[model samples]
Target: MSEKTGQCLCGAVKLTARNVPSTFNICYCDMCKRWAGGRFMGLHVAKDDLNVTGGDSVTEAVTSDWAKRAFCNTCGSSLWYEVTDGPYVGGRSICVGLLDDTSDLTLGTEYYTDRKTRAYDFPEGRKQLTEAEVLALFAPTDAEEGEPE
Candidate 1:
């Protein structure tokens, strides 16, 4: 993996996810839709791998009983997330807009199919999985501590 760095729009918060995330997700969950104003493309970084720096101006909201969403208060840029207790563990699902080369990354999975809007539709045959189905993506995998195996 390469060193990829991203900063909030107002520069009040900076972060580094040292390696490519073990997985990714494109979420259509209502919570995500409400937080993202439509849909959310998230890059998953393990709790240990997400470094929150210059966070003096970062603000967080408890979007749900088990999750917290963080954003840069200075520029209103949704930064990352904290899954208090869920199938995802503690991964920080950083906003895809914060990434530098998001185009190079492959779309992994689109989640929350049950709640997706009927106003829009996924084209072709992209896999769409419900919440329980997508949770399977976070299943334990064989990998070295600091590297993808």
Candidate 2:
């Protein structure tokens, strides 16, 4: 796909991303829900492919042993979820809602499905991964590479 542009709610932070796909993943983990107020629909992108302006306004908090969360310090709009180590190093999961245009993007997968709260449920048939399944898919691969899981 072509490059896309977007900005935070207050426009204090703007970004341009190249080579973005037409799909995004949804995370139903508790941390995701707490951070984003619901499922976090993130557009997966390579870190280098995403360029930002007003970067000084972006602040990050290490949310886990393997990744950190970034947001606009001015408006608190989520920017992206970054991997600190492992095969996915230099990769980021950009917040889909931050995109200026979202007409082309589709739901790719849902992670932490088993942990999804009872308050919300999605339609059946989408690709789904439970917490255990997600760990099994990523942990060993990164562990073998000597990166923190």
Candidate 3:
């Protein structure tokens, strides 16, 4: 139940999250890569425990039917990725790159290994899951029914 505070680039938006775990996750999906300019590193922050000041400066986009991403409108700094609907509704993963301090964060997991390109590679021995495996872990139960599961 650690507490951390961070702000977007240019300090236009300030955020605090309570009950944060010490681990961070990385996403290597194409959308994430395009969003963050490479793999996206995120710190899981519960929606209920997150507080933001200067919300007026934050703009969000619905990246997918199930998720949306928010960023600082002023500096265009990536803020967070949030579940928009389904079982993960209200959950958020904040951008770790904007953290004011991150001496405590450890690599927890990486998803979209299959999407990883030969142009870049992370260190060996990281716990990783391919795109299909990620879908199995996160796809909402409703989406699984009657779909190509």
Candidate 4:
């Protein structure tokens, strides 16, 4: 893990992340594609590992019941996608394109593989997960419903 710094296009939103990972993931879910104007390349990091400046210029939109997406209000640059509920609450996925140095980063996973369009395709041989698989892995199970009476 290493420290990294980046900012939005207009420099209205700056961020410094510590203990950053060496790999990033891509999301091809419909919302991600629409929000990013394509696939969303993100680095999953704990909220505690990230620090943001120019927060006044950042705007967050609750896109779903469990997640919120943030962007630079001044420049409209996508900032980060954050989980707000369930097992992954407080987790943040920072936009990979915002990183100052990406030379050492590698593709970790491609999520929502089933939602990926044919218009674009990454190289083969990388790990991929469909929407169902992702939900199954991360979605919280009902405690009582799963337990035997």
C-alpha RMSD values across all candidates: 16.1, 17.9, 17.5, 18.7
- Model 1: weakest 10-residue lDDT segment is 140-149
The superposed Cα distance between candidate 2 and the true structure at residue 142, in angstroms, equals: 62
Q: Write down the TM-score of every candidate.
A: 0.73, 0.79, 0.79, 0.80
Residue-by-residue lDDT tens digits, candidate 2, 15-82:
99999998899999988888888889999888889999998999999999998999999899998998
C-alpha lDDT of residue 85 in model 2: 75
- Tens digits of per-residue lDDT, candidate 4, 8-66, equal 99998999999999999999998898889899999988999999999999999999988
Between prediction 1 and prediction 4, the one with superior TM-score is 4
Q: List the residue pairs that clash in candidate 2.
A: none
lDDT of 1 by residue, 1-149 (tens): 55567888877788888777545688888888878777888888777877778878888899888999988888888887679886987688888788766656777899887777765676788787999888878765566345565
Best candidate per TM-score, number?
4
Clashes of 4: 0
> All models: lDDT?
0.79, 0.89, 0.90, 0.91
Model 1 scores a TM of 0.73
What lDDT is reached at residue 73 by model 3?
Answer: 95
| Superior by TM-score: candidate 3 or candidate 4 | 4
Best by lDDT: 4
Off by over 4 Å in 1: 118-149
Q: After superposition, how far is residue 96 of candidate 3 from its true place, in Å?
A: 0.3
| Candidate number that wins on lDDT, 1 or 4 | 4
Error of 4 at 121 (Å): 2.3
